[model samples]
Target: MQVVTTIAGSDSGGGAGIQADLKTFQELKVFGTSVITALTAQNTLGVSGVMPIEASFVEQQLQALLEDFSISAVKTGMLFSSAIIQTVAQMTANTKVPLIVDPVMIAKGGESLLRQDAIDAIINHLLPVATIVTPNIPEAETLTGKEINTLADIKEVAKLLLQTGVQCVIIKGGHLADRNFAIDYIFFKNGQSFSMQTPRIASKNTHGTGCTFSAAITAFLGSGLPIKEAIIEAKKFIQLAITYDLALGNGHGPTNHFAYQNYKETCEVIIHES
Candidate 1:
């Protein structure tokens, strides 16, 4: 099995953050490895406390993994501060491996996972080196300084992010004008575009869709799939995850990661572009 590494925070909730990432990797048949940036006292209720792993320890964990694991690709989630962001960027700079950077700013239950000051650091240090940057509307607004209200807004947002040197950018359209359809646009730096549309399931069980999507991308890339194919595969995986999911927490419940098995027909994936 191909080895993939996730550099992120640990969620006690087993929903979003590193837990979801690892679960996505496992479900997709990748050997998962992780270097935790912080440990949080969190559940489906909310994040109670966050204890950051020191920069040295984070560095050691990453170095040890890269030294031994032959990581095929890497993904990042919650880096709590500018210093931690810089450390992660520096560590991955010379490695020249594919990286998926999820700009996780706010939790589903409205908690700050990233600091405001760290935005500039991620824009400067990490985005340029990212193979792809996945940002939801709020994060896209922060990165591009644009109001995302329409399809054109999403396209421009993708354009602005690509200017920062990211090879591909996906601007999630969940917060867009579409209320029933979940629309997300993936734009290559060269202006090629692929838009994914799915019926938005009206359930609160979408706790970790973003984390799972990006981790699926990393897993596909770790297995040597092309970028477009990886994203297409990841999107189909998330759609199934959201379809038959259980509403577990009082807050948004965890997505049913195994829902793919039931609807193999609808969940059937075409990795290459149709």
Candidate 2:
């Protein structure tokens, strides 16, 4: 079986961090491993507290995993501190495996997942090694110091992200003003770009959508799919997951991770050259 590792925070609510990532990896038929960077006291409502693990301990966990498992790909989520982000960057710098960096900055309930000081760490350390960096609009704005209000701005932000040394960038355009359709912009350092558009599913159970989407991409990449195909497939997986909502929590609930297995055949994703 293909093995993928998620280095992210642990959400006690089991919706939007390493828990969601593991669930996504399992559903996508990849063996999942994890090194938790922090523990979050959060539910569907909001994040109550976060306790970051020491950077040294986080490194030790990563070292143990690398010594034993041949991780095919690695995805990073909420690295809450600069120390933890730097440690992850250093540990994975030589892995030569596909690295999916999810710039997880804010929660759905408006709580900050990453520290302001750590944003620079991500740009300086993590992005340099990332195979693909996925950032939502707000996170992209924070990373690039530019606001995204139009399609042109989104494209500009994607371009700015490429200068960070990442092989590719996917800016999630879910926060775009257009609610009729949700679009994600994908750009590569090789000067190719594509737009993946889907009819937005109106649902509150989108708590782990970003984590699940990035995890799916990591899983597909580990299974030997080409990068473009991996990203398209990941988008389909997330669309299905969002479509078949489990509606578990009162606030923003988790997507149905298993939805892809059942509804993938019926799902449709549209991609166009940009």
- Model 2: how large is the Cα RMSD against the reference? 0.7
State the local distance difference test value for candidate 1: 0.86
- Model 2 over residues 1-274: C-alpha lDDT tens digits? 9989999999888888999999998988999999999999999998999999999999999999999999999999999999999999988988999999999999999998899999999999999989999999999999999999998898888888899899999999898888799999999999999999999999999998999999999999999999999999999999998998898978999988988998888888898996
TM-score of structure candidate 1 = 0.95
Candidate 1 C-alpha lDDT tens digits along 105-215: 888888898888999999999998899999999989987789887777887788888988999998876777667788778899877887788887788788878888899
Name the 10 consecutive residues with the lowest summed lDDT in model 1: 265-274
lDDT of each: 0.86, 0.93
Model 2: residue 50 alpha-carbon error in angstroms: 0.6
Model 1 root mean square deviation, Cα atoms? 2.0
